[model samples]
Target chain A: MASKRIGKQTVKIESPVSIAATAAIAGPKEGDGPLRLYFDMIIEDEMWGEKSWEKAESKIVKETFSRLLSKADKTTGEIDYVIAGDLLNQCIAANFGLRDSEIPFFGVFGACSTIAESMQLGTMLIDGGYADNVVALTSSHFCSAEKQFRFPLELGTQRPPTSQWTVTGSGAVLLTNQGSGPYITYLTTGKIVDMGIKDANNMGAAMAPAAVDTIATHFKDTGLPIDYYDLIVTGDLGLVGKTICADLLKRHGFDISDRYNDCGVMIFDCKRQDVHSGGSGCACSATVFAGFIYQEMMKGNLNRVLFVPTGALMSTTSTQQGESIPAIAHAVSVERDLSS
Target chain B: MYNIMTKKEYEKYAEKIAPKSNIVRNTARAFVVGGLICVVGQIITNFLKSKGYDMDDTSNLTALIMILIGIIFTGLNVYDELGRFAGAGSIVPITGFANSIVSPAMEFKSEGFIMGVGAKMFVIAGPVLVYGISASVVIGIIYYLLNF
Candidate 1:
């Protein structure tokens, strides 16, 4: 048997998996953010006539999948598998989102890192020659997440400045063995790291070390220079985690400060939007990547990109029980053209 | 395993990086909002008393009216916004308690009235009531024993 393990926790694919098509949708507030124009669609009504926010999120995911299929110019019959996730409990959003499509679905949960978790799995299935095409998608809604993870929506509780707003959006990506130039070249799976930070509101602080650990591991395994990638972005570390991640990376003896960015920070102008820390949730990185990063690659602006979606694996029950948060991050490297 | 720092040291480090909540501003806002709520309660009490209501009846009526206002504010989605700006100012009053109950009730209404609104309405208040009643009973027992 042959192995594609590159180094420690990293994997080198036998052949590049192509990123064929992508779709992203944002809620009204996100649609008004700095990356507002990047989303394929912006939903004004959060409920969208649905009785519940969870059902509305499912609709968002379903629509994003259809848009992804249309962009890829393929019907559901041609798609082999669907790997998806969300911030909802029991992964209900993804489960119901793809239920009617008749696609073989794998529901994943990595908290906010769900998009990258699904994407990496989709890449593996295609590269392993087990499937021709797979769709990876994720969604999150603000109201649904808040009610589930924290307080009731109408409760007059004050959120601290470090608290992040769960993003209201969904994103889908189509991956195939054969497609355009942009390719998935590397993946580094992260280990759960708990820094003993107990505050659920400061997710950035909780997830930053895991993101930094994965980035450092990727560099070590690949023996790549820090300047190799044009951009290195984390999933949703927001303002605080981004700084901590950078400082932690510096301690690891690598500096990509000039190019380091976070999806949570990029998706919103925190100061103006009044999103204290920034945006979070599974959709934060998903919408940013599917809509913004991939489009930038298509335009030849970013040739090499390191995408690390970070997740805090703590549940409300765990947090209430006084267990500190355990965070994980998955890193996937995409290049415009592998040959170049 | 990722770093040499122990969990405690790393936690301390994380604490250093995270931005602190503006305590002075939050406290000041909470004070003003709480004071304003008290003023509103006083006005209602005075008006009710002027209408020939006794002190006890005026106090009870004022609390009822304040709770009603809290419910309306929560329904109109204005209380949460005020809560955000004023921190505990909007949350430390009788109106805040009303907002807490009505807000959760409204949020869970979509889950259905039985398990959703009915069961969840007392999530926060349940503990308050349990402890409040229990402590009152304990104090009453102590007073009775002393008199005997």
Candidate 2:
């Protein structure tokens, strides 16, 4: 049964997939932040007793997966596929973390937009009757990301105001073909949009246009009004990008000023935490969605929500080569089942 | 509201929303911190020379002592704070190099001697050593050829 394809990029999932269970673990810095209570585990140690930040990240992912599965009362044998990624090169965290799990793995790389991308793919797999249980996970460690993307922690380099702190956390969500509620109903795949801005420090600027473009496209495709959903969230677009995204959407006559929220901006208290713009990275949206947003949905406080996770697709090599950052975003509509 | 604009319009709006850098403040901070580091080096050299050490020995000893201090500070996790505050001031000095190597080494020490500390010790400093030594060799060959 082929589902209805909305306008160009939107897929209206006829049989929506349900989020069975979600688990999130955060590092010390994120533990100290405002959303600490939302996370399942807040490890005081950034290294999590691991040798390196990379290993620490892997440890976080593995733990989050186990916790999520346990919470769903499922074993590795029951899971169909594990879709995961991180901010490391080649998605090494997912590779090494789930190596011994014996579950079939699908490694995805969408920069920070990995969570939404994974969920969208997971929903498609379930809706398409390919698999039953799929776990979509993403992790990002501040130290590991900083070492790869910018300066080493030892360098103590001054971060600019526009720069965002990569969230040190991992979040996992269990998407299943059969579950009670909080169903994934639609997905809007974003096109790569580059505005020729090459500054890696200001990733929010590089990613905002893509977010706006995708949001506009989602509304156009679904023929849904701005008020169709209770909430509209963007992944990892910090304070600077949030304003720009809203302004751009407003210019197109969709003023979501009151309903819009950003995962990056929501994760940390920018003023107190010294996290200049806000948080970014794969875990920025991952932890926020798995921890805060999903919990909100489960509690029945919110019904329909549009989650658009944005990513600035640029590597250190690409930035060094003076290539402009190409940004992308993926949208998923999650709604609570009225009957359930 | 209905019409999509050209790329030029998008660029203009993006430029308006982007964060601006405080160039003057950053430059002044870098200058003060960098100058202070140099002054400390000079003082250490003068003190070493006053102790009857030769110029060559004093210079070597000064570098060794500075690096030792940097490693100790890095071990204590204080050098990173200085780095955050001083920016280029902290990075331009030999101490920064010492900090770079020691920090990763200490962080990865938990992985054991060989694969962890030994392998990752040069994670940050590896590129600097490679380029620095390679450039020096190239310059040496050029100098030798010209003189010969």
Candidate 3:
């Protein structure tokens, strides 16, 4: 196998799974953000004329996957497998989205960390010689997520300040055994970490410790210095979680303050947008990386990026039953070999 | 990745650090909004009373009018925005109760009128009704026992 399991939870891939292509579709509100220009498509209507938000989310997944395949100049038949997930019950968006594609599918569920989870699995399948090409994607709709996890959309209730808005978008990335250079090099699987946080509204604080744990584990297992990467980004730690994550990293003897960023915090201008904390959900990191960071890497602005997608794995039932939020974060190291 | 803190300690620490909504601002907004809702009711009451309706009819009419406005605003999708800005101002009134019921009904309409709208209509307000009625019954029983 080309992929070697390293000390503890890290995996080192010898042949490096190349990122063939990436696609992202953002909602109108996200299109107005700083990363707006990076998205392939900005949907003007939230529902996109669909009868329901769930169907609209599935359409987003389908379109994003189609665009990714087209960008790579490969048909669905040419791909070995498609790994996808979403922040919906039964992973409905992914299952229904790719049903007609006829490609072998792997439905995953890691809550918001689904992007990194899918990408890691896809890269492993390729590096292990089980497949030549694989597509990894995830989607999250703000309305659908709120309907399933929080409350009805029309509920006249105020959002607390610590709350993060679920990002309305979808992103897909194509990974192949052979391609010109930006490659996925390492993977660090995360363990469920709970700090007794029961408040569902304050997801940022709940998910931050998990990010801190995974980041610290990755560096320890790989024996890599914090300065090795140009950027260390988390999935949806928003402003509150991002700050706490940085602080915790410093305490872990890894002061990753300068080059660190969070997808949730970056996706929206919280100060101006009034989104309380910032953007979240499965698509937060997915769209940000597929649209913004990947473009920055392709532009030679960044050579190495440690992408960590965080998830708060809790249901309304679990929270209502007084269970703490169990959070997880998976990390992948992607480096661009531009000189070659 | 030993966090060096107990779960309870971490919970307390996390709560302390997280940003809190400005209570004073929220309270002020709620006060203004709730007071205005009451003022609207009072005006409606005065209007109906001036037209020779009894106090009982005027009060009931005032509640009916406010509830109608609430449902209308909810259907228009503008009440949530007001609720967001006004906090509990739009929530503690008769209209808030109407929103709590009608909002879920409209949202769940996709599931079908019988299961979705009818079944889910009272999800948010169901507890309020349950506890309110239960408390009233308990108080009535206590009063009867005391009289006996």
Candidate 4:
């Protein structure tokens, strides 16, 4: 049985590991990432407990991880490896959370592209018959991010509508090789595209072209039609970027508007969520992919999928130096058979 | 390390300079910096036109050029001085980012990039740029589909 049911197999990804993230540093650091991120109950301290971004983000990742992983199967032994990273210096927040996990880990920095990067690597290792299971995770916090890169939130600054809310959460997916899980079949590394856009408030527009380019490439390489997959999702392009992605695909002769959606927009209902525009950060796309959509696909709601996570490669220096915004996005194709 | 005087300390320093300073001279310097910034922007706009860019494209080009000029001034330590005298006249728009970036860069030049310059640079601009380009491409596509 060579398996003609590759595309229909039901694959489920779960998080049985528990983690708590808290930001340790609350003070400001330019381009520093977030200040305070911790797990468990956040201790509201004068310096950083409540107002410190470092503490908040650290707490978010830790708590979110703890909540997700607490339900994991205990027999899995020590986590083989904690594959994670953040935008901060040394990715200190990620480091803080993973330090006590007892599982060996490696730090990664792909900006917003971190979720897919980790997922691709984790999936590959499992597919190659190397590891039976792995946990892929990432996160970003607002306060820590602000102190590292922009004006402090205490400064009472108003962000433009194009700005994205850095999600204060962490997501983890337990990928196993032995289980009848959704097999991540192919992974495509995306190229960086700079459309000469510089406004920070308008990330969706800058990143949409990259999303289209990657999606079109995925279809071209796989010879898969737009309708082949139940859904084609992109990471964190918010409402504006999601719209741009749909139109660009249509222009390329691929009709995907009907089945296509974005994690950035889906994570937060615009009107109800009040997450101006939509969600972003490592956790924004990670949680949506690992939690909501992954659950849907497992329940036979969504079988074939194309997960494309996008990132913008602009630092404060480049923006200040008057360079155009450059962006990058990656896509992964996964298929599952329900009737193994 | 040069101790940057706080606002109160700067007030004390200002008193010492006030007696010898010429108000008209300061006003003229302010005009010069402001005028120069505009001149550079105009030159960029005209250059774009000569190169066959449309009006819309030229406006975008002009904005980009102005930002670059702002960055250059910010780098040379001149933008800050001009800004101090011009108030919000120079602090508005992309020029503010330029000033914000250059000051820290010059301060941490000795620390190298990983910590000093690279890490501290995106304080105000990172998220904006991240979401800006990402959203634009998406919006551009959406517009094409609904309208096209």
Q: How many backbone clashes does candidate 2 have?
A: 0
Supply the global lDDT for candidate 1. 0.92
TM-score of each: 0.98, 0.89, 0.98, 0.60
lDDT of 1 at B68: 96
Which candidate leads the pack in TM-score? 1
Q: Once superposed on the true structure, which residue ranges of model 1 sit more than 4 Å away at CA?
A: none
lDDT of 1 by residue, A273-326 (tens): 999999999999999999999999999999999999999999989998999999
TM-score of 2: 0.89
By the DockQ metric, which is better: model 1 or model 3? Answer: 1
* Off by more than 4 A, model 3: A1-3, A338-340, B145-148
Interface RMSD of each: 1.1, 3.4, 1.0, 22.0
lDDT string, candidate 4, A163-225, tens digits: 677665566666665555565655666778766566666677667767777787777765767
Scored by lDDT, the top model is 3
| Listed models, DockQ each | 0.81, 0.43, 0.80, 0.02
Model 4 misses residue A248 by how many Å?
1.3
Task: Give a tens-digit lDDT track for model 1, residues B1-148.
Answer: 4575788888888788778888998999999998999999999998999999998899899999999999999999999999988888988888999998998899999889999999999887788889999999999999999999
Model 2 segments more than 4 A misplaced: A1-3, A338-340, B1-12, B24-28, B54-57, B100-148
Model 4 stretches with alpha carbons more than 4 Å out: A1-51, A272-274, A338-340, B1-148
Expressed as tens digits, the lDDT of each residue in B41-109 for candidate 3 is 889889999999998888889899999999999999998988998878999899999999999998888
